[model samples]
Target: MSGMTPDTPARPEILAPAGDTPSFLAALAAGADAVYVGLKHFSARMEAENFGIGELTRLTELAHEEGRRVYVAMNTLIKPGETGAAWRLAARLARRVEPDGLIIQDPGLIDIARQAGFTGALALSTLANVTHPLALEEARRLGASRVILPRELSIDEIRAMGAACPEGLDLELFVQGALCYCVSGRCYWSSYMGGKSGLRGRCVQPCRRVYSELARQGGRPQGKDAPRRKGAPHGRQGEGRPPQGRAPLAKAGGKAGRFFSCRDLELGPLVKTLLDVPHLASWKIEGRKKGPHYVYHTVTAYRLLRDHPGDPAARKTAQDILELALGRPGVKARFLPQSPEEAASPDKQTSSGFLAGKIRITPEGGCELKPHLELLPGDYLRVGVEDERWHATLPVTRRVPKAGTLRLRLAKHATPKAGTPVYLIDRREPELQRLLGEWRKRLDALKEPPAQDTAPPAGGPRLPKPVKPRPRPDMLLTSGLGRGKEEGNRAAGSTPGRRAVPALWLSPRTAELSRTLVGRTAWWLPPVVWPEEEAALSRMIDRLWRQGARHFVCNSPWQRAFFPQRLPEDADLLAGPFCNIANAAALAVLAGQGFAAAFVSPELSRDDALALPAQSPLPLGAVVSGFWPVGISRFGQAALKPNEPFMSPKGEVFWTRRYGGTLWIYPAWPLDLSGQRREMQDAGYSFFARMEETPPQGLPELRREGLFNWNGALL
Candidate 1:
């Protein structure tokens, strides 16, 4: 292990994700500048193999000895009741491993770390959604030393944001791996479509699934009287357009459906631009869930490019390895400074792996091939014929290379016309099989025998006690108008013995229009505001608070960090779903931070919500019924006319609105928990029912009704 000596050149860090011990070893062997790992619990990648606290000493010590940094991701949202346990774990990690940085997403977790006197650096996770320079100020206020910028940004946007790094916080970019269709923090598609949440690390990847739209029809148009909604000004290409550049992955319901799937991030060519950006601290690889082979090859290519920028031969060799390693044609950086085409449509949604050769199935059976590239016996073959969008992957039984036409053995059932194109699936191959073993040995020699690990037994920390909540049949009702006439109707109509609270979310425009509305009771503020809206919003809050406004709801780390100092300590602080609280530890920490109540995520199942009461450190509330926000987008136009729904090819219309650079997309289906209210009360969590702006006519019904996570089922 090398020491961090003074004479060592300060190279830009290459951050890698290590899902488990073996991956961590691979990262070290392949020259990762730093390694990020997760604890067995509370990490965003819950499905991956993770390290428990007992293994921390070994992971961190090894990285430190090698003069490389190690960061632990305690990045998931914590429910109110579970905060104590999370804090205890964080405290234990901080006291023991003393990691180089604590990469986190939740505000409560940051409070917990500070409360426990954690002195190490804190890196804000992408789930925090720091998309602008102003947000970096908010991050600094929250004690973030660095921010992992979201992957949705264009290279131009990255450069613009990176220039501000010297002022408040350092910036990092995702240099490689699977790209999410929705912006990291803003997406709720998985939670809505599948019970699994991308935020909690149980994403079912609804974006990756195939969906063919049955039909399309016109939806309600925005009335002329409504506010004129717009998106980010155009970039010569178009205004807030669909992601620019790249071709579709595979044939979908044509190009329109292809917009829903994203090409994996492969920035080898554009990485030079990332490196050119001054003050950009690190380039991160995104796969903690990927296997060891993927990590090794990826790191190796980047290392070669990073060390020898001008060597074309070295660059070509590295590029070939990357192409073969990628398992498919790598997605070029269309949005980068230079590219072949204009940023128009999306890249192919399907990746067919590595191209083997052009092939044909002869009448005598077996297969004929051009044998252009190397192929191993174990590799799987995907045949795609030009005549049709024809594609099928089969195992390669044997390969006997000859001249222009070679002989190959495929499955007996396989048959394709002559001159059909072929691809080889990325599998164990001779090209890297021997190298893999060599790297494994090198990794083994770095750490001593008898794997060093010591875990504190359960009950080591004074965790918050689990107690059934003291039920007080109090329910809060809200409406669409961040302050409208129908807003307070439900809460104001509570019957005797039931304490109903009237709360309204107000915008700066609404606050100015109706001084009476902003002058009094409980009100919630928008989590993210445009720069121009900030002054007005600040003044509005000041006036409202002086007039005795107490209850407020926040949904971002930025808001949490900024709002506390402005509002008095006596205010009843509440958190919205963006806070992502789903367990007891999350609730306990928020309560400790002085939040009066926090909205439990709709992603929680009936069982999960019911379980919260026993561990809830503060009041638990649920939006029983309303439009579910599925995405918080920073790019693309969602031209939402107030009260009108945006229709999809699937025939579903979603209600949407724009706020600054963000567009909030809400599906038409209203999440209804009315039938489960009694059961929820019994579980001791407060219920907040949302009434429509204009409840539909004919016996009063919404277009669609859903149970959200009431069933608590996860895939």
Candidate 2:
């Protein structure tokens, strides 16, 4: 049975954002059950007023006093030599501030949290981009207490995820906030385009900027043929610019550039559907960058909605508050299923974008957007009907204006029902069907057949055959890292009867090193490289597999595209930190894709991580020790000069501003690895150390006691 009793009220937690003390207090007073905040280093929001040790202690105490929990955000990617410091800091904070949990994004930090003696739980950051059950199980193995589902999942997807997860894992979802067009917490476009690393908490959002381009045959603009327009006089080039007074371009291809902005996500109306998902522990509100008024109004609205779900007046009150917070403009569900016509394009004007779920259109022309609230009469609704997109309005009328909720104007003969969806009367059904058929055919042609080449090319090295293991007990102990020569000698002298540790994780550059230990225990851990080098990685993995290695770790989803034909059937494909497995549904998807194990992101809460293994379908491998790179992106490439550090003129540095050019910094301290091992043991998972560095002086022996204290200071 779970920890909660039958009599305990099934009150879903109200998790709020606190960029600083003021917002923290406001959220707590507004009835937030838990509050999440960031530190000076490793948080995604480089501009938020973050807390230091002193402020964090006070904030934690204050929240605990009000029966609220505090979750400190250390959710950023760690640079080289930075993991040790970040781990120590997490341990120190866990000891001093006694926060309910730590939200993290790096696996190395997860080890630091364990090593520092932090007894608090771990929560995975959304940046982990975890979308599968195997990923969740891996997180559970890594000592996560809770998992924050990605903001892109739909209600049906959430339900399926909840049903698939191992029991006892708690799930959290974002019910409000600005919707990110890039995958939640994994975007590096800002850093790639600008110099700011989103993983390191500094992001110059280039995605929001406007650019000019030449007209193309289709709706898109042609990149090379486009002529450059001079910056507006006295206006910035990439920053906000004054509108050039000009007539809108004709519908035919034109020279104007396409806008790449996405709208915020508002799910105020789908409160009931969200509440129905079992094992859901919290309903979150986004926007640490928003104002106090936005926080107060939005929090109050959701609180009322959750408490009085069935009350019509209460629902209306929530909607009113939401509209006020949203600035009362148009909103749309992003990521949810939509016909091409129903889908909001990059050019369409709206306050929000795609929502993940099913949308149904009523005969009365009123479209009911599920899992998304904040709908009003006179609101223009888009729907995917019969595989084609169409626009309609609530309360069908003979005539309509372009925008806004004006007074209803219906024809004398029209008596539209309240629930029926009213579509524009002029749509041609046959034309839409024909168009959809052609589109499907075009998509089908893109699919490729498997490569016919199985053997290595001439002059290439010969492939090694798989080795059979010697008979022993069914129980196998696999230490994730290989002992150094000296350490191996010491171990050999100390324990003659001990079983040899198998499965050493090798870096990308050390592929040649694996040849020295061929036919022995070994696995490849691919480093994050440029998109152009992905084919090279695929070739390398394929070569390694044929040469005897079967286990592997991929750093990101983009790398998955390279292995389309070469994914090993028997190999243990451990989803790396970049996979960001935060929920059971994500884990399920990974399992379907043939992953044998996975690494949980450090950003998850301890409770969420613990639940992951129970809810997942594969073996969990906890990140016990290592300096896992937190910010892995092509953005770092942009800053590289022939001999200079990669820096961005438009980008802001995360922690230290004065330093320029490809700035790399460490976390405040190391994670407590021992603590995580114990936690994973308790959760029924076999733990392994991901040692990116030599085990500290006392650490190797401490592995036996399962108690090690590594103190490195924070940035």
| Candidate 1 local lDDT, residue 237 | 13
Clashes of each: 27, 89
Per-residue CA lDDT of model 2 for 521-631, tens digit only, reads 445443333222334555666677678765566654324443443455666566665565544434444555566665654444455556556655555555554333223
TM-score for candidate 1: 0.72
- Which 10 successive residues of model 1 have the least lDDT summed? 233-242
**TM-score, each model?**
0.72, 0.49
Reference-based lDDT, residue 220, model 2: 23
Q: Please tell me which predicted candidate would have the highest lDDT against the true structure.
A: 1
